[model samples]
Target: MLNNIGLPGLLLIAVVVLVLFGRGKISSLMGEVGKGITAFKKGVSDGSKDDEDEDKTLADGTAARDVTPEAETDQKKV
Candidate 1:
């Protein structure tokens, strides 16, 4: 069904949408969409950085640090 929509058909649809929702509304919606995409990209980059930080290894190939300070104190008490 959608395959039949050529450029003219798309333009017609866009015109109908613009008529239904005024230009200002459409422009603001597009602006919000752009902001959402930018925030999503930033979140993905920050998550990748966190993964890289967690992946650091010691010279023996073990994880660099796993124990918490509270666990260390408990071990000392034993």
Candidate 2:
């Protein structure tokens, strides 16, 4: 039953939708859709970068941590 829609039928449906919602509303809706797709892509890329950083470790087989003031002073005295 769904296969019965020909090009003319699709065009009529599109025309009716356009009439119901003006051109500006449809255009803004499409713009929001585009922004959402872009944000999703960016989030996926950032997540992969974080995973890669976590995989890195020091030569002692322990995970790396941020340097503290005490650790820095001890290293300097040594």
- Could you say which candidate leads in TM-score? 1
| Candidate 1 TM-score over all chains jointly | 0.73
Model 2, 38-63: lDDT tens per residue? 99999999999977877786667699
lDDT string, candidate 1, 1-78, tens digits: 798999999999999999999999999999999999999999999999978866896557678865678978898899
Against the true structure, candidate 2 reaches a TM-score of 0.65
Cα error of candidate 2 at position 8, Å: 1.7
Q: After superposition, which runs of candidate 2 have C-alpha atoms over 4 Å from their true positions? A: 58-78
Each prediction's TM-score against the native? 0.73, 0.65
**Residue runs of model 1 more than 4 Å from their true location after superposition:** 57-78
Per-model clash counts, in order, read 0, 0
